[model samples]
Target: MKIIRSRSFTPSRAWGALEIANMNGITTRLHWTDQPYKWHVNDGEEVFAVLDGRVEMRYREDGIERSTVLETGDVFYASVGTEHVAHPLGAARVLVVETQGSV
Candidate 1:
C-alpha cells in the first residue's frame, strides 16, 4: 500500500508524470505542469482530475473549439477521438487515468 500527497508533488519538467498504477492495461498517473499541452486525441478514454491550482481545458466538439476552466478538484473526461489539450494556469498537479502507453 502507498500513500500519495498530490499537492506536494512536483515534476522535473513541464508535464512530467509519476506512474501510480497499471491495472488491466489501464494506467493511473500523477502529473505536474506549468505549460500547455498540444492538441491531440487519446486512443482511448481518459479521466483527468485537477489536484491543485487551475487549468483551462480546450477541446474541439463537432468541429467547434470550446474551453472551460477547471479548478482544484474539478475533473474532465475525454472520450476516444476527442481532440483536446490542457493549459495549466500556473503550476498544477493532476491525476490522470487512461490506457497504458496511450497518447
Candidate 2:
C-alpha cells in the first residue's frame, strides 16, 4: 500500500513513454504528452485513471474507428489482448494500472 501525490509525479517528454509506479502484480503508470502511436497486443488487463488534463484513446478494429476522450478524474478499463493507442489532448496526464491474469 503506497501513496503517490500529484506534486511528486514528474511529467514525460514524449507520448509513448510511460512512468511506472507500483509494479507488483498491479502496475501503475503515468502518461504525459501527445503523439501518434499504437498499442500492440498484450496479455494483461489495464486500468486508467485521469489525474489531470485531457487524454484520448484511439483504435481501429474490424474496419471500425473508435475513440474515447477522458478528462480530469475520468477512468477507463481495458480488457486483456485489446489493442489501442493513447494520445494526450494537451499535455495530459493519466495513471494506468495493469493487472496480470492467470493462464
Candidate 3:
C-alpha cells in the first residue's frame, strides 16, 4: 500500500502527474491542477476518476467535436489515438487509473 498527499504532489503547466501506485497491472494516482484549454494525447487507454471538484473534457468525434462536464465521483476514459483537452472546475482533483501500460 502507498499514500500520496495532494498538496505534496507537484504541478505542471500542462498537467500535474503523480504515481500513487504501480503494482501488478494497476497504476493509480490523484492528479489535480488548474490548466485550461490544453490538449492531451494518450498513447493508450486511460481512466480518469473524479475525486473532487469538476472538469470539462473536449474531444473530436466523427467529423464533429464535443465537450462535457464531469463532477465528483464521475469517470471517463480516453482511448489510444484520441486527442482531447481538459481543465479543472474550481480547483478540481481526480484519481486516474491507467489500465494500459505507458507508451
Candidate 4:
C-alpha cells in the first residue's frame, strides 16, 4: 500500500512526473509542472485530473483550436487521437492515467 502527498512533491525540472502505478499496460502518474506541454495525440486515451493549482487545457476539434480552464479537482478526458496540450496557470500537480509509454 502507498499514499502520496502530492502537495509536497516537486520535480527538478518542469513537467517531471512521479510514477504512481503501472498495471495491465497502463500507467498512473503524478505530474508537477508550470510549463506547457507540447501538443500531441495519445495512442489510446488519457485521464488528466488536476489536484492543485489550475490549468488551461487546449485541444483541437474538427480542425479548430479550443481550450478550457481546469481548476483543482477538474478532470479532462482525452480519447484516442485527441490532440491536446496542457498549460498550467502556475505550479500545479496533476494525476494522469494513460497507456504506458504513450505521449
Q: Which numbered prediction scores highest in lDDT against the true structure?
A: 4
Across 48-96, the per-residue lDDT of candidate 4 in tens digits comes to 9999999999999999999999999999999998899999998999999
The TM-score leader among the candidates is 4
Candidate 3 global lDDT: 0.73
Model 1 agreement with the true structure over 18-86: per-residue lDDT tens digits:
999999999999999999999999989999999999999999999999999999999999998999999
The TM-scores of all predictions, comma-separated, are 0.97, 0.71, 0.75, 0.98
Candidate 2, which segments miss by more than 4 Å at Cα?
A: 1-3, 15-24, 61-63, 100-103
Off by over 4 Å in 4: none
Clashes of each: 0, 0, 0, 0
- The lDDT per prediction is 0.94, 0.66, 0.73, 0.96
Better of 2 and 3 by TM-score: 3
Every model: Cα RMSD to truth: 0.6, 3.9, 3.0, 0.5
Ranking by lDDT: 4, 1, 3, 2
State the TM-score for model 3.
0.75
Better of 3 and 4 by TM-score: 4
Q: Candidate 2: give the clashing pairs.
A: none
